[model samples]
Target: MLRALCALLGLTSAAIAAKFELSPKKFLTLPLGDIKPAGWLHDQLQVQTDGLAGHMHEFYDLVSKSDWIGGDSYYSYLEEAGSYWFNAMVPNGVLMNNSIINEKTQEFLEYVLENQDATGWLGPEVDTEKPRCLWGRYPFFFGAIQMVEYKPELTARVVDALHKFVKLANRMLRNGEGVDKWAATRWEDFVLTLQWLHDFHPRGEEELLVDTMVRLKWSGVPWEEVFSEEYFPTGPVENLTNPFGLELSWHGVNMAEGFKALPATYRFTHNQSDIDAANLSWDLMFKYHGRPSGAYAADEMLAGLEAVRGTELCLVVEAMFSGSYLYQVIGDLKYADRVERMTYNALPATLTANMWGRQYLQQQNQVAAQNMSPNPFPEDGPYSNVFGLEPNYPCCTVNFPQGWPKFITNAFLVTSDKKGLVQLYLGPFEVQTTLNEDNLVKVSVETFYPFGDNLNITITATKSYMHYIRVPSWIVGGSMTVNDGEKTGLVPDEVTGLLSVTIGKGLTKIALHYPAKIVIEERPHGSIAVHRGPLNYAFDIPRSEKIIAQDPREPHAVDLQMGPIGAWEYALDADPATMSFHNEAENDDHYKLPSPIFDSGKPSVSIAVSACSIEWPLAGDMFVTSPPENPECLGDVKTIQLVPFGATKLRISEFPVFAHSEPSLRVGNSYQIGDDSEPVQKPFNPTKPN
Candidate 1:
């Protein structure tokens, strides 16, 4: 079955064999500036620029005067605050081409690179006897690599400095120097940098790079063993006292970063068990702790499936990055599906619509965004869910910027054979890259995806090539029409879920329609969640936000305490088959998606369903606890609209189902919702020879 799937994905025997011997990446990611955001996506980036992404450095002292840039004080013991800012802002600056941000990024990069110690070690750590934590360098190098990609002149300097660091890292790992703390548990970031250097700019240092990877793997946490069924935690962790011991494995951000370690190491080991364990890691995570918003419960530690449990913003972005990496390495459609799900739903749900202030943690069924006594999170503080600057910690403030920029750059990938282009995730973006070695191709995708069902793609190529469009597993009966000709049904490869189309040179226009339908997902405690396309839907509770605190340096950026101004205790009282979509876009031909599309009252699509007010009680006067197993309607059923999950600041995503009189509606040839179908966890066999 694995061999047959590989063959279906166009993997030749040679390519399959290469998997066991430092194989080529399944997809080659385009550089940072190659893919530019367009349409609403462009607006989204611009808003980020005008918000924290663009101004944080100017006002935030942790970033402006961090030790990495030679400041006297630092934000954390790991010295990663500045590096986190750099990792996020560099991509944002380069993608938006913002002069101010780009200039600032260069200034920071110059200081860090020029001040590298004679020992090849970066940062401000000088105590030689003490064990150095190499975790900070991982994010620092991630940003530095992008800078080199955008500016080729710095390639030599950056490459030389990285080589020196890797040599130092290799020696340190051999001894007992680094990897003593968080670095040991989350060493995938370090290995990822090594792999990048090996694949792109080995410069005769390939052996050293491989050795460094091996040493890192050996010294790092044995994630394969941890993710095994015998050891993997099947429920929320209760022990919070020993956070640095075994409990660190359950840390949300650590789990998000560590899950990808085995998959990444597989590129070198080519061990089939590593691949299986990697797939199982994902399956077990979602099964036990998954949230309806595509995030797993991890406030600071692994919280359970209770709706009130918080998922940190840092975890959300890290999971998206890991998911995208898994897709690129394993070439599985399921990983891509997850990436889309998080990008469309969870990423935006945690932030303020303007992107100025963000929550340290978000709840799946949050009724208010405020501080709580006896907080819901096992390890986070009371203010974790409030919208503020550095509410619980500053990590998210710097780390969240990488989410969208990386997503855009990874949206389109060149196939491993370099003969075709694969549209991995759908969005409004323009990509300019070479396929088949030097065949320059530029493709523009314009769509209100997750809102509108159609993608209008225009391709202009110097040479004809095969274009593989990923048909999202959520999409049913998708079809395509080329050059305004008759529409043809698209039959995607069963395993890969990709529809291949041949594209000729010059201008080619294509219209792909993925008819969106509602899906009812059953959740714990007799609750249910609604979905359409890649988006998760929620009851948008109207809220009144109060400015509780303001940053004097940037007064417009203020912390918010928001509570529901309207009714939020509601239960679904209608059949899924009878629900209808209320799309604002359909009513107007010239509908423009509102700027800051994630804001309330701006949703382009919504679902109107029969619901009744219920007497769901709060856990701690702030947290919306689990709904009643059989919620009784308080009064007559009324129609309420559910907007996209990302658009609501206060929402009920998982709702209790109120038994209705009508039977389940089944339309002709329509997909049914509320089915008991689990996601297929098919492990790819890396040892399979072509």
Candidate 2:
């Protein structure tokens, strides 16, 4: 009977015999807690745990007194805010192994599971006339799915409850019950959860799961049509209400989540157009709205590449999630590159070093983080860019916690065939998983990547296996040595760009050396952004932070108004040959990363460049306008220090080019310190597909 049904659906006989049937993913994601952050990455997670992410439940009304947890204070009728917190906290708690957080997460999970409505609804909206929006369950079930993956004992109960909810959701979606404004446009999230069940725990209910996914896709916004040239916005969206009315395509958060909608749908359809549309969406998004921080400009709506324009923190984290998802499904190197870029640069730029406060919006040329009177954001409020708890909205407050935890989980992925272990993202992590169902592989990565140019990888495997590592596009020339023997130049596959190496039985050590060089990228208005590896370099402006408001229950959780105290109008010299790189961690074995590594002045790497103050003006006395084209140098040239973009709260990232000399240098060529030879200039052809 299953084979007949599979034949009817155009599925293979092998798929019919399998647990569930869906188009195979290019790579398999490890279970939530299979990989753990280590070293500086570990410290990052610990800081997150000690900050707003860990303590939100104690004081925050939306989380502490949420409707889902049997409390009265509900953020919305959809009951999404608390579920956002749950989705983030579950993974963080499990990865950090924090007992307190774990207990809270488990309590919430148990409450929702035990309180399932008799009609099969999962949330608090039991009113049949006004059926609850299915959107909220997207995040809630995401967290529940993670919990089930980590704890097998609860899988049966959770799966049963989810199956019941799925039945109701199928009926509700078919009858046009819960799919509405936000829910209709963002239905891909629900499809993702349904696909998870179909892939992992569909106990003889594959047909129902597939049917639900299809219905949800039909009810959701047509992303392929939305991304087509005829309908997509070529520039910044002006009238947010007109062209894309009712679709909410201009909204920042929706765009971020919707970016992966077609990709998710492709899993069932297996259509090439779906993948092409997703890829096209990515190219167009970054082309028009891309920021130097590896995020797009969408303060509230889809803004342009103007320096003063801000990107929402929620958009930043959501884009990271979408990027990671795209990479897992399509095995695209560009997606992985984007995820790493955002993770290293943009994710930390919006938050306070302690992770207690975060900005709702972050701008590339931000010189101040105070409330703006005439800001550039089209739909956001004046307080959008200020760093605080729930600065502009509470959604970011609950949603931002998922960024680091999910990144850690996605750092290592098993190849589709399960015969190869792939290091998808560079970070300090330890992963223990079974490859090929029997070969147990435990790989430990230790290094300060993007901060330092060395990776110390140790693979302990029960049997010989093939290991693959992604060679970042920014690398000029990297080399690897096995067992500290003769070094070989790292060569990546021409098609996939992955550096493959064979691993033997038992334990083996490998050392990778990638020379870090300064890269100059030309931005709009002839401005330039500096890069070394995945880290974007910016002029870190010293700031004076004033406390404006505080949480009465927790005085430490305060809103801050910050402004630059130092000169931030500097423009870099056009010639890259004169730039210098400094590594303070070099030759200093006693050097230790500060408790909060993203804090200003804590980064061990700095770029010294010859620059001068340019005649730049402020936009509405709030933030700097676009970099002045060929502006006159206001002062004598001086050496200025550039730190990682994540290290600064107020920064000048996109700088004007100060043309003080002749045309002897090019923009794409990289500069390495201590090399006595003249630098070779090369045309900049970015690895991003057009």
Candidate 3:
């Protein structure tokens, strides 16, 4: 039976022209908690689960008891918001390859699945106000796949539910029950879920079901033409006068998810055009609407390249998901690099250090995280930047948790042949998975990562295995040492250009060292943003947070508003060689932190530089805009501190460089520091990808 189904789903010889093999023979995500976080990552997840994300259902009616997915009566029936809340909050206490013991998650899963009707409806009963929605089921479908690793016992049930729903959906489309308006723009995600089902559960009528879903999806949107450059303009369609653009691809969240449709379809058709379409879509987005923090401007639509424009948290998570799948199908490390930048920069900056509150929108060059009118976000409300249980929308409060858990899952993956482990991103993590069912590989990676350049990986396994490591494009002369031996340069692949190696099992030690150099990036309107390795440096604006209690009876209604307590406008020397990299926490033991492991106020690494105060000021803008082009030098250059972008809630990431300043070079000992004694090197002039 399985053989017949697999053959039925296989592509024909004519469709294999440009096909590439995925690293893992199977596309399986680890069960929750399988890839356990270590060092600071572990602390961050604990803070997330212990705070609102873990217990929100108890307080928020959207997840606790709404009509959708058996919740209470805040919404009439299973609405779009509830479905998203379930998808984001489902992975909270799940341990990878293990069972979900939390009574809340367990009960939620049991109630929803057991209530599945014969008609393939898993949500609440259909009513006049809330009829059956294909859009509502789509989120649940994707969420079920994400949770399947931790809840293996529910695999068959999930597949069965999906089969029933797709069958019913096919009938609805044939009988003239058209796709819901809300679901039309998200056809890509629907197709993506169908493709995932076909990949994982290809032992039944998988091919027929997926084809039906794809056809049903395509019947609505002209996705093929929309993704092409001819149909979609490669520039910002959003401006101050008109913020809410109606074009399907112009909407930020839609475009983020939509980029994956062609890539996912390419896995079956093996068509080069599919790959080209995906590339074109991404190129256009970054070329016009890109942000300094690795996100695109979408105050609900395609805002421009300015740093003050806000991006939705939903778009941020969706873009990460799209990038992960794009990497899996295309086998490229660039996708991995994009995910890392967003995870470290945009994802963390929106939430509080304790994870109790979050903002609906975050700006790349934000100087204050406060609620204000006349904000730049054209579509969002005045309270978009307030950190709370739910600011402008409840969607972010539920969607934000998906980032860290999914990042942990994708950190380490098995190769296509199951003979190697691919370390996609750099961070402190420990993973235990089988290489080939008989060969168990256990690895512990320790590093300060974006904070520092040194990485120590220890591997213990039953048999010899191959390993694949990613070397970012920014690294020029990357090298690794085996068991405290000499460093050797790597030979990367011709196509992907990623570093690959073979190793023996049983307690092997490997160390990676690459010098961090300053790379100056030109922003819109001739501003500058500095980068060191994967970390983007930003002015650490001192902030004063004010917590407001909206309702004394509802403690969860409290919101946090922050404002800058110091000046945010500064222009640094134009020469990248003059900036000094300093580690203030170099001597302190990481394990001996007083309480909360990460101290955002005092970042571990910082940039010390001399800068002159500028006349750059805030306007009717969201926060503070970019610094002036050639500001009046207020006084002599004064030394100021710049910290990692993710560590600061309020920051000035994009600044104006002082072009006519005297060169004052200083250096340090990391990455390939420059010719000077201080650890500095000449800038690597990188061109933005087309």
Candidate 4:
């Protein structure tokens, strides 16, 4: 009788059923207009659309041609690229600031939805003999999933279309048609969409589809084993040890996207080994190919840890997405730390300050942003750094726009229980959400965060609730204050770096103050990377742009070159604690108003330090490479300006340490000097001197 009553009311028997624990999406993303970008954030979004990501269609035949979707074209990937613009770039623009792209976005979305074939394949049906690539399907899927959140009216249509398409894809996979090429290589992307659909619409067979797709993607070797194999990064892509060599983990983009594969599968299997493997894979990647910019080297392949080796723009955005997913699935704060580093440093360094130009590959020690015959990339062309609409490749053109928009979207996240809220990442933004279905909570976060360590949060709530603020792992000895209450030391989670606090009803103001100090990190060679908070410091190399070529039709596809305007070879002469920071906002109130810092195209913060010229040498083509071994100082010590690594177009990030005669300033294995200024507590250990 009890079982019959429970069945009648639609309650499941917890014993027999899987309990449907809210899939991968227990927390919801705010609508496009809910957490709008403010200050510099708004300006950057506008510039993005006004520039290449928005205007590529005007000049490129792939984006503008009607045949891209309906007619047979050799370059089928362009069709997916078009879908990216419609699915993400356009909607993101309007959502960001109600830009002029709204009307066109509406028109494009309506056309795609209304014109869907009865068979449910939304893309063009052409060239059945062609390899039936499955990877191209995912970009559209990502766009459609995002649409389900942005436009609620389109949900039913999108869901039906995705369901029918997944069934068709599953059929193709069973017949051995779509299991061959790029689809097989980057199966993680396809698998993630399956997981998403199953969780969103759990209408019985969705689970079967997800499981089938996961199996197809897994082939014979489990993803955990694939990630755990230790033979990586020894040679070229052909030398990989796994079966189906040169297919999956060797590619940088695949490696990044693969970071989430094990975690995604863990959802269904509940395997602890998957989690452990995911952590191990990250360590291996960093150990082999990590760059100072918090990304792995992949100049179209697994490049090694030379500071000059470049990372693709596609990898930057994909890695951030992977990090975001890992944080959501694993609830790890270290993932957030990685995301912050990549978003602030690697993502912006590839684009021009105005967002009008971008590079296909960005190098950490880049001295000249121009094409060279013998480029550092194994497969990239000479025009990699020309910073046109698409320099060496156009994949970045279609994919890169998603980086900032999604980063902003993920700025504020709710707790798994939906009772508390957490700031997953920080920038200039506001978050408004309801807690417990009755108490409304709104938070306004204002600060030039990475540029400044102080953050002021104003909370207006209808009732009391718990708020979790993430303290970055880099921060030490920070303090938090609430409504003029006792200033409390931030007791951060040693592992996750989160600080939790409770708030009462009405409006309350909280201030977070963390001291910003520079710490030197020893790099691969005998060089050091200077860091403060989350920003990496680089020598302030001046740059002048030279236009190489331009498309007569489109204004955005102009090949431009950047050459350094100042000398870049300098060694650290004084301690990091003596490094001084200067920004005009310190005196100007108008500039201090909270906004994202880069949109203005003017980096406000500058680090001043005493440095002496060094005898560093350059590689072929005059490009700066690894700093030379501890060489004699060439010039008298001079005070030079260093800017944030992300702010400069051409810079030398790592520098050799200078030897000094001072006794108290001795480091781990070598001697150095410090000016009269106090020294930071945990300075980098000096590398062993030759």
Candidate 4 lDDT over 1-690, as tens digits, reads 323433442334541125433245434455555566665666667777777767665556656645455445534432456665664565466455545455555655565666656666566565544655666667767776766776778888888777877777776665666655455556777767777667667567654554455555544224565566555554345334555454554778777777877776555545566678777677667666776677778888777777887889889998888888877777676678778888888888888776767899888888898878566566677678778777887778777888888888777777766677777687677777776668888898887777767778899889988887888756656689999899988876555556788888899898998655555666667777776666777875777888888888866567789888778888885355556767666656567533234532367777787788888777767578687767678879888877777777788887777853334444453222344264333332322100
Scored against the true structure, residue 20 in model 2 reaches a CA lDDT of 42
- Which 10 successive residues of model 4 have the least lDDT summed? 681-690
- What is the per-residue lDDT of model 3 for residues 521-576, given as tens digits with 9 covering 90 to 100? 67765577777777777887888888864535357557988888888788876666
Model 3, C-alpha of 635: deviation from truth (Å): 1.6
Backbone clashes in each candidate structure, one number apiece? 1, 0, 27, 0
The model with the greatest TM-score is 2
Candidate 2 residue-wise lDDT, 608-681, digit = tens:
99999888888785578889988888889899999999999999999998784543344332333334453322
TM-score of 2: 0.93
User: Global CA lDDT of candidate 3, please?
Assistant: 0.68
Off by over 4 Å in 3: 1-28, 66-78, 95-101, 176-178, 239-246, 494-497, 551-557, 585-599, 660-673, 676-690
Q: After superposition, how far is residue 565 of candidate 4 from its true place, in Å?
A: 3.1
> Relative to the true structure, how large is the alpha-carbon lDDT of every model?
0.80, 0.81, 0.68, 0.68
Better candidate by TM-score, 2 or 4: 2
Candidate No. with top lDDT: 2
